[model samples]
Target chain A: MAQSRNADGNGVPPVGGPGAVSLALTVNDITRTVRAEPRLTLAEALRGPLGLTGTKIACDRGACSACTVWLDGVPVCSCMILAIEVGQRRVTTIEGLAEGERLHPVQAAFVAHDAVQCGFCTPGMVMSCAALLAHTKQPSADAVTAAISGHLCRCGTYPHVIAATVAAGAETKGDGP
Target chain B: MNRFALAHARTIADAAARATTTVADAMTAARSNATRPASLIKAGGIDVLDLMKENLLAPDMLVSLRDVAGLDTITEAPDGGLRIGAMVTLGALAAHDMVRRRYPALAAALAGAASPQIRHVATLGGNLLQRPRCWYFRAAAFHCLRKGGGHCFAISGESQYHAIFDNRPCAIVHPSSAASVLVALDAAIELVDADDTIRRLPLASFFVAPGRDTERENDLRPREILTAILLPPPAAGLCTAYLRQGERSAFDWPLAEVAVALVRNEESLCVHAVIVLGAAAPVPYRAQAAEAALLGRRVDDNAARAAARAAMEGATPLPRNGYKLPLFEALVHRAIMAAVAETL
Candidate 1:
């Protein structure tokens, strides 16, 4: 939770000048320092600067779930959050979900249930479902819908998404992962 | 898209000190800049960023409140009430065990709002304090009264989404779906000023009618921030519910919504009642007559019908919004009946 930035006198005025800022972010158990444009959102910073483009950017605003990530354990639209303001908070993107190619239960359910169509909204949907399953091991159908309601998919694949979430919960019933 | 410069605040006190003082201050700040400079109170930036990209908003400076510590908590008061911080996101409040158990209506309202991603980012303060979502206001071409134009186009133009009650000069309806439930629960808001001065007032008193001031919707000024929402403990034996009937399940504003919170006394008689109508007025309409109709009476089918009938008594419909009256009446009836049945 501790973060510090260098006051390099590179601060630009209100309109347009310098494009980047010195930011320190701890993402997925790795503390990485990067210079990002002031206009660059956390989503863009992770995808562009850190080379983790798994965090998609669909609406470019908070409305779409393509850029969703867990900021300090709470899922938020990374596009809405400025990269510089992210400081040293822990960020968990979809890239951080698996351990050495072994798919997480949510990911396995998504694969087993054929939830990814077009695959653009998969990262965000999987992350949101994982967050829900983290809190509730066996969530009902309504809970799954509410969890993913903030995400929008033009593919119209809600039924499959719900199935994947329920399957993930059932698979984790023994270990309660 | 052009580059956006930043004015970051290190603390809440620092942020408040840098904010413009009043409407006049905002206008002056806008003129002093080479561009259309305005203050975007960065409460989660859920709605602000979208409005900006849509060109509906182009503020020169963004004053962020996210750095304000102690403004993202959900705690139970010693009096058994709940105090929700302004910066608390809809997802956090909805997932809170206390909110889910004590005020199920509030939890339901939060859950029913935008998608999971949106709920995760949209703050409770921004959800209530955000402006109405009138198409005329959002579209740059319309330039309606809400956009500082002289006439409200919703009256003469496309008004299918306009108000059904308490709209005088402007007919735009309030866009908050959570506010209806909050007001129905007799919630109060804790407003904090730049000087650290604070005031706690009922949520109903926070809204201003269009007849009073079309230029603004609430009593909030430039420097004041909605710090907390205080929900009085649910009355004993109460069962509250929020019914929002919208054009679509997700992302669309409510066409008609009702929030009913009621409790019966030891004698199985109505002791407390609250009914609020959404998408009907400039603000969340407190169904005063409907509440009066149910006072001290058994919340049976007949009483619910009478209350619903009285709810639409003061509605003044426009050309096309006349349909909202019946819709709102039926919604209120259903909500009350559900609440009553749960209490039994």
Candidate 2:
């Protein structure tokens, strides 16, 4: 195998390792170094070595959005991305969705609206809904449904999820004043 | 997934050098009829990672294009043609103002594909070159022909979601929703070889039919990289639409899909038409007969039905999937009507 070589002056392209390499990932605004293989997924790394297990792995594939997280503030499947490939992008999981002691508006709304049945799909659901509220504060019911469309809640919490997301968007302030 | 060496290529040249070694290993393995692990290139790692986890492909090395510069932008040419880099995500492509206004069909195609998370992660290059999501091919126990095995399990097994037109060799339907719209827009693609040689050809030629070769879906090899997509300038009086039906409303594979592009003369007669079907066959199936049937005719309900009928001329549906025949015909009619409705 070709080792990490700085062939040109392009500033260290192949910087990781074939075995376990230390990665300085800026997850949730804090930089932490974790030793992992190139094949370890971001979700696996986040759950195992980092000990941040809020991001649940249901399907372990792209079929279910139970593993959704924020890559540079946009929602993406954490299970689908390799931890090493994340490079310099900021990662935000469910653990980073709130501030100090205040729950995120979507999280509060989920509690108020009884949106957690099995609670397996709640973390990723909250991430997608919170991302939607950040963009559109007064999102329509259809928009809320579209926001969490990728999420598969076998607990049949879709109606409550939509209602909670809609109320969360309405309660919170949007991008503009 | 097996442990593989990962290389983050800072430049395209760096990637090209790695591709040469990968292609060498691939050719050697192919010649020996051995199931040896070879090197591969991946950017988003959306579908490739899935393939790897399923034990379908175990690469020895992975040249990551995650941070490759100059391949993630969308630029408009001096002649108003659009040049989209391969690394552009579906979400970015659909949200572009130029794409939404000039090519509504393409915008629709990109919007209707996958989910919000997938759209943000999976690139357009990976979408076009993605492998078919066949049950037999995906399962390790089947050992289908696409994996260089003996038989196609879908032929005698559960084939409800299989192909209707091309049912002899393999029953797996192509899964790209944007490909049909791109073909309707007459897009071209750029592919870079291992020697850093760039070749641009029509996007239509990029696909390989199951009858031609059941082993591979597209012409891309593990060593080649799909670089860019070039969309020709929007035609005068061009109106287009893409419509698809899936089992579920969101984040689902297309059950029946159609993309229709047409140019109408001042007399309300169709002068040009292009109809392509997605998830219908092993390739983006072009309905040449349907296009010919609509030329120089008024795009009324009668004409639309006739053209849709013409589109299903050679369909040979399997026993379990004969429902797709009517589904495709109705989708074609709706797609044409949708495009015509946009004109008003």
Please give, for residues B196-238, the per-residue lDDT of candidate 1 as tens digits: 7888899999988878777667887766778899998877688
User: Model 1: what TM-score?
Assistant: 0.88
Residues B56-174, model 2: lDDT tens digits: 66677788887788789999977789999999999999999999999989998899888899999899988887888888888877767777677888878888888887767888888
Deviating ranges (above 4 Å) for candidate 1: A1-19, A174-177, B1-11, B21-37, B235-239, B263-271
Model 2 chain A: worst 10 consecutive residues (lDDT sum): A3-12
For model 1 chain B, the run of ten residues with the poorest summed lDDT:
B22-31
* Interface C-alpha RMSD per candidate, 1 decimal: 4.5, 1.8
**Index of the highest-DockQ prediction:** 2
DockQ values, each candidate: 0.38, 0.73
Q: Candidate 2 on A1-177: residue-level lDDT in tens?
A: 443444466444564556888889998899999999899999999999989999999887887899999999999999999998888999999999778788988899999999999899999999999899888868999999888889999989999999998887777656521
Please give the TM-score of chain B in predicted model 2.
Answer: 0.94
Per-residue lDDT of B162 in model 2 = 86
Clashes of 2: 0
